[model samples]
Target: MKKPMKAALLSAFIFPGVGHFLLKKYIPGVILAGAAFAGLYFLIAKSVETALQITEKIQSGEIQFDAATISELVSGQTAGAESQLLDIALAVLLVSWLIGIADSYRVGRAQDKNVDASD
Candidate 1:
């Protein structure tokens, strides 16, 4: 396979910025990996907190186990401000992931171009 495609696939499927690592772009690879990990951590923690809150509400009879209520909880509308923060965190995680993929792809392509030009 082509170098760029290989790097892109590695970044997309394995870890964010792995393509940069493969191309010996250490600083960017580390930065992207760190940011992606931080975003993922925030998202997971918020999701767990939301899930625990929902469970507590259900057990305490504060919330009903109906479709609409469940929908609201899942949508984070009825949960309050923390839920809003969770939504923001989730969006950040997604955006970061996408950006990581796109950046790695671009870097890989550029490295391939440089290699070709030098040949």
Candidate 2:
């Protein structure tokens, strides 16, 4: 609705930090998006790698996956506490992106809504 918000939203459509760029909050937006990217990358690739390794082991009769989960999707099997933080990072990025866009828009809107306010 506002310029900043619009920009932030548009930026999110590109990556997750574009909104921050539009809002002029470069540092936090970058950190948030970078962290999200790292998390998502590890989650997808790590899970796929783990699955492949497990599959090979099973084929060779060397190891077997647990019975608790059968899907073997990419969302699971990514270990480490940093990864756990990925979820939070992703959330922060999304929220920050949205806020940046929204705030920018609102700020611009407030400054310009009145056609005669600045005269």
Candidate 3:
């Protein structure tokens, strides 16, 4: 496979920045990877926190956990600041992943051109 496609596929299939790292673009790779990880971490943390809060409310009889009340309870549980953070984290992760794929492909193409030019 061509370097550009290979790099793009790596970044798309693997975590963001793997392709850049393979191309020896350490700074971009590290930044993309770090942002992705941070977004994921925040998402997981907020999800867990929301889940725990819901569980606590259910356990204490403040919110009933039944088919009729499930929707209401779940919505209410996630209707606070944490939900907004989760949304932002999701957006950031998605954007970073896309940028990483495009960047890695561009870098790979540049490297390929350099190789050809020197031939």
Best by TM-score: 3
Please provide, for model 3 over 5-114, each residue's C-alpha lDDT reduced to its tens digit, 9 standing for 90 to 100: 88889989998999998999999999999999899999888768777887787899987778667666657766567678779999989999999999999999999999
How displaced is residue 55 in candidate 1, in Å? 1.6
Give candidates' CA RMSD values in order: 2.8, 4.9, 1.9
Error of 3 at 108 (Å): 0.5
lDDT string for model 2 (6-39, tens) is 7656655666566556666678567756755765
Candidate 3 residue spans exceeding 4 A from truth: none
Which candidate number maximizes lDDT? Answer: 3
Ranking by TM-score: 3, 1, 2
Q: What residue pairs clash in candidate 2, if any at all?
A: 2-105, 3-105, 4-101, 4-104, 4-105, 5-101, 5-102, 5-105, 8-19
Which residue pairs collide, candidate 3? none
What is the Cα-based lDDT of residue 75 in candidate 3?
Answer: 72
| Rank order (by lDDT, best first) | 3, 1, 2
In candidate 1, what are the lDDT values of residues 1-119, reduced to their tens digit?
Answer: 87678777887888777877887889988887887787788877767877888888989999998888977886763367776776777777666667767877788788878888999
RMSD of 2: 4.9
- Candidate 1 wrongly placed segments (more than 4 Å): 61-68, 76-84
